[model samples]
Target: MQSKVTTTKEKYPDKPITFIVPFGAGGAMDLVARILEKSAVKHLGQPLVIINKPGSAGTLGWNELVTSAPDGYTIGISASELFLHPLYGTSRYNYPTALEPLAQISSTPVIMVVKADQPWQNATDLIAYAKEHPGELKFGHSGVGSIPHVVGETFSKSANITLSQVPFRSAAEAVTALLGEHIQIVFINPGTVKEYVKSGMLKTLAVADANHLVDPVFANALTFKEQGLELFYGNQFGVVAPKEMPADIRARLITGLDAMINDPDFKKDIEAMGLQYEYLDTKQMQTQWIFENKKLTNAVQESGVVELIKSQKQ
Candidate 1:
């Protein structure tokens, strides 16, 4: 049943609100959720309950949130790319109409990386090499439906190479695999690989953006597009609720989210991740979600990963 209290001020006046984080503790999504939890609770005069549901590249827990009641009692922090998972390949569930977009919390690049001493000097060199040896190149990602996983798929379809995809549990795990030479390449958040690039532990091949990430790593690293590739852009994350929620309730949630988006603390935190405060309202989110779903479907059809994504459903 819908909560009798429709406003954030009204509904959350007496009790805590639960925010489901689709990744494990201490990861990027988790970190953002924790901070926002503090700010949101203070703003709303209620506690924000953060529950971590980590598995299946974040799909496992996200599915849980989507299936929850449409009342404003439950909310979720999830990545934008997850909407692409089922279309990209296969999964047990879909991002249901029960969920609505509260806001896009922040955006980050899915960057391509390699061992510091790899033979390739730039993305072009890597592409040339991969073209010559398709499927021989190995790349790592957090999991089959992760941003990194889709990023790899996007790059391969654009470049027409058969780079093998390896899925790990976290960005740290994928980076460690790269360091240990267990994998030759992987797409990761800049923060996850920044220390390694500084210490000569890894090399940044290209960022999914048209330009390079200049903060933790300088912009000269090179872009995949500059290498004559056809793809650009990567994943971002957001806050969402059930789709059929009342207008007033949606406004209340967005109000809370907008306050946090404009707050100094949230800005600083996102900047530290090499991310910008690019928030999307429900309409923008829906439109983009549809567009991305199409791209993912095409990619999956081309890459032959539909069955793989299907088997990963938890």
Candidate 2:
């Protein structure tokens, strides 16, 4: 039985692997998953078939991943949400318990943006306006308990201001609402708004990160700390699998993901999309997730988002 199990693990994936993307097609995560699929042929000697399972602010797909057979055949892409959703009691599986960290593919700084036509010029300008108007300024995010939503909350708390919160199904939808002037502001990754900023449709106020964006259009945007606010946060994208996946198979999958992420062409593709090519191996990924979880826990309490969400539900 032991030898049989060893042989089965050695054979590993005799067929195409199912790569589940916990978001809609054409979204950033989906695009990243497709890029990995392209690299899989070179690194894993097997094709990766992508399936979109977007819903419930990404919990649907994550639940799917958590429930899938603990074989190397099933894997999925995850973002900050993997550690975040469970905090708000949305997901049945938490990061440390239900999923095994693979390798992080990329990271991007979150930026505060508004329609270029709005009067606010920078983070200070927006905060001042929001202070006087209180809850009048509507702020949109991907969803409650999502990265953007938390960032927006943290920023509001740090700045001692108030803004109305609006939740959308996805970042793309929030961006669309901002474009249509349905919302006055949004906190999102710089890559998602790069084109809009260049086209003069949206203006970035501050980046909630330590470093400024490398892209020329966003290079001038200052960090929140630089603007006198003590807030820093961003999103990290990575792969994960069911926690009980066999060890040998898990090792094989990690090896493939490491090779695919480190490929020069893959880095180029990631950068071209305005995402930073930040790679973290399995152990490093787990450490980073834990670090983020600690930070987010504090933010959740300080921002009072839990109470706010509960009140809204009522």
Q: Which candidate is the best by TM-score?
A: 2
Model 2's number of clashes is 0
Which segments of candidate 1 are over 4 A away from where they belong? 1-13, 128-136, 157-162, 214-218, 246-248, 298-314
Q: Per-model C-alpha lDDT, please?
A: 0.72, 0.84
Candidate 2 to truth, TM? 0.92
lDDT of 1: 0.72
lDDT by residue (tens digit), candidate 1, 1-314: 34544444355436677889876665667777877876877566667899987777877777788778766678888676566665644455667344666677676777888887889977778878999887889999877777688678778767777888888766777777888888899787776666677778788878777766657554677777777775555666788875676666667667777887778888787767555567777678777667866766676666665655556554
Model 2, span 53-131: residue lDDT tens: 8777788888999999988898999898777677777677775578888999988878899999999889999888888
- lDDT, residue 163, candidate 1: 84
* Candidate 2, residue 178: how far the Cα is off, in Å: 1.2
Query: Candidates' TM-scores?
Result: 0.83, 0.92
- Which 10 successive residues of model 1 have the least lDDT summed? 1-10
| Total colliding residue pairs, candidate 1 | 4
Error of 1 at 51 (Å): 2.2
